[model samples]
Target: MNTKLIAALSVLLVAPAMSATSLDLGYKAYTSDTRDDNAGAYNQPFLKLSHFNKADWGTLFAYVKLENPGEVKDAQHGADGKLTVKSLAIVDKQIGSSNHNLWMQNFLVSNRTVMEDNLYLGLTTNQKFGDLFINAGAGINYSAASFSPTNASFDGLSGAAAVINARYPFALAGLKHSLTVNYEGQFGRDGEHKQTLGYDSYGHQLITTLKTNLTKSVYTKLHLTQFDSWGATPNDGIEYGIAIGMSF
Candidate 1:
């Protein structure tokens, strides 16, 4: 981990009372069927920390994710733990015209080689028509060799992806509840390499989420993720988990 970088971000997050900020800490446990060639499964437990800071340009989000994956056959064989950091910046809501909703920049780094490090810049927009909210975006990705997935085939592979998300919020028990659906598709050479690995050469994921407010400032969320692999990756599977957090 880069202690210096973390320290810098920590300082930015706590700058002053006027800089609206929030932090979330949570845990998730998931099972993957792709492990052991479907002979058994891979289990993972993860710790997640996420922080957000409102800025004049936009909103900044920093996240730390830690997980250990173990297979049923030989838990020790894949016992290595992985730690990752991801940061994202969204354009200020006040900056855009009625024609656009958001713009974003993102970067990710991980301690493990398989996880890779990458940078992305993108444009995203959200809209509401009645009770349904919709979002869409596209981005470019530059994968650094130190963090590129093993199948990337070359150093600094570049890629692109498109995303779509939708949500519906309702009232329940005098509180707010919501259901969200999300989809992301990856395209380009890196995606081709992914396909060669039994994954979708142009990879994609479909995710659904259910969120409910437990209190004025506390919430619980559940997720179900489905993956599509066109015979490219070794571990294409399903994942589900629950998380609880608070907003300040």
Candidate 2:
């Protein structure tokens, strides 16, 4: 009775009889603006789930976050609210077909740990050319300086970031509508060659996004962000969000 345990019990009895399924749970919302005078208005809501593995290496994403009408230009304003948890590994073949991909995370759980960075690399993707999904990766960032509370144990963050993405879809028989876009940039070696903690603190960031996926589990999104720093100054931000999430 041991032909490799009867072929591992007939591959777990035909592997759930041909398994592949989606939709575990989701709800998302977003709002943002740091146009200065009014000084950063924000609303962020998130929930996500993913579990569907079919010889498909890995996939397990979990999330919960909330930030609304929150503001603090000079700094500190009660408990504004933002919670998070994440996990992901979705690589579906291609040193041969070029569906290129990679995502690995250690600690990206944040609220503020001086500025947040306990060791990182929480966002990563790679794929160039159309099945219509491009990719890039980056991480390791932590900062402090909102109005000088003397919290400069400085190692201030971000020395890497790159992004470019696109996604497209239209379906009928099973129902589907998916469209997405992206652009991102960042690099640095923060904190004064001396010691003048103003706030460019040290930076460069540009982000744009859009997303929709009705069936295959459901989705929704919108985002925009821009920031150029080094005290040279230019801080522009905008974000509007929606998410009806689920995927497996």
Candidate 3:
């Protein structure tokens, strides 16, 4: 990891410690199958740390994943024990007489293997429908190479970006279960940009997760993801994984 990324990660890891009451932390171990043509098909284990916090002003969610944890070199899918960090935050704001449902959202993603940093900024709204909760937003995206040796031609003003996150909770067979869906899409890239990126002008990643609580602090999850015209090379495939985690 670079010095800047390391610094940002340090702040994320310590923020929850500073405000325990508002933060929820969890750890998960999962094995996912990658079906990307260039990345090839491989089953790799990852250890993930997730943190969520809801404050009076807004909310924060972040996660860090250690991919191919046991490998130092030549790991599965060329992971090389890389660390991936993603963080999303919403700042509550109200326009005129409207309720406090309007907000500004920011998302940051950093990956060493791909040597890329992605960021999105836009306005968002929160809504509820019976037992389901949703947060949706649309904005502009900026993507660039984080370091040298990576193609930077596609960097700067990648295109339009949209994000949707929804969750529904219920009790099933006396167990508390929740279903969550998250989507991230990018489009509106010019022809030259698309050609340089080696992907379609539009792309998206949709992930659905079903989580069931085994105990007050323990849970298991099943994850399914669809990658269409996504990634640095625009890999398209379906990936699935199972995970066990504990939240506190």
Candidate 4:
């Protein structure tokens, strides 16, 4: 048993793993309960669906999500868009021994339920250099709302927006773990040929999320988000949330 012979044997032992890949399906949920001294306790919940498959080029993925019984929508008496859905696809590849991923998701829902519905398109590329991964991307959003105490019309109005995201991943207890930070921004104006929404601007949100696997078919996540706006007619605020789910 010589040193060179041992070295060659080691490479052979690990080479099989290099050719093998993985694919898994799982569900995730985020639910939060809050208590306000001046008001009653409140709750908001969301669920996410995910698919991941490995390929020669990279890993392919699809994810879907929905937010139900949200804070503001409840106050509207259920006439608004009470559910928010999001869909995404991306290619993830490892580079220079560091994992890299390029992905995008379109969020098809809005804070205002009566809106004609909106889409937030986000594109990001991340590189893992050791324990921390760095990512940056651009996004766009657009939507218009219809509101009426009896019967209202906002179909005439429309808005456009942009977004960005950053994340990092590593290992915990021999399992994968990640921390994600996201930022979303929207530009307000009229669609087709209409005046701006007051010649003013509206951009919202700073969010943080933590992700990990609970089991082979289950995963968990926690998130917090905030919305900030400028000017009067006061259109802005902050929010907190938590959730967990099982994946298929």
Which candidate leads the pack in lDDT?
3
Error of 4 at 19 (Å): 17
Write the residue-wise lDDT of candidate 3 on 142-195 in tens digits: 665442334544567778888888999999899999999999888886564566
For lDDT, candidate 1 versus 4, the one ahead is: 1
lDDT of each: 0.55, 0.40, 0.61, 0.45
Please provide, for model 1 over 1-248, each residue's C-alpha lDDT reduced to its tens digit, 9 standing for 90 to 100: 23544454454453333343334444443354445453222354555556556644344555555544231122335554444344443332324445344444444434434333444457777689999988777877655433144444333555786778799999987889999998866677474445334444465668898988888778888888776541122455676777777766
Q: Considering TM-score, where higher is better, how would the candidates rank from best to worst?
A: 3, 1, 4, 2
Q: What TM-score does candidate 2 get on C-alpha atoms?
A: 0.27
- Residue 76, model 2: lDDT of 22
For model 4, the run of ten residues with the poorest summed lDDT: 33-42
Say which candidate scores most in TM-score. 3
Clashes of each: 10, 0, 0, 16
Rank by lDDT (best first): 3, 1, 4, 2
Between candidates 2 and 4, name the one with more favorable lDDT: 4
Which tens-of-lDDT digit does each residue in 1-248 have in candidate 2? 12432353244332332344443332332233353422323344444444443334323222333322132212224444434343222222223334443443222222332222222334555554655655555655433233234544444453554455566655655655655555544455454411333344344445454556665555555555554542212354444445555555
For candidate 4, the per-residue lDDT at 201 reads 58
- Between 1 and 3, whose lDDT is larger? 3
CA shift at 248, candidate 3, in angstroms? Answer: 1.7
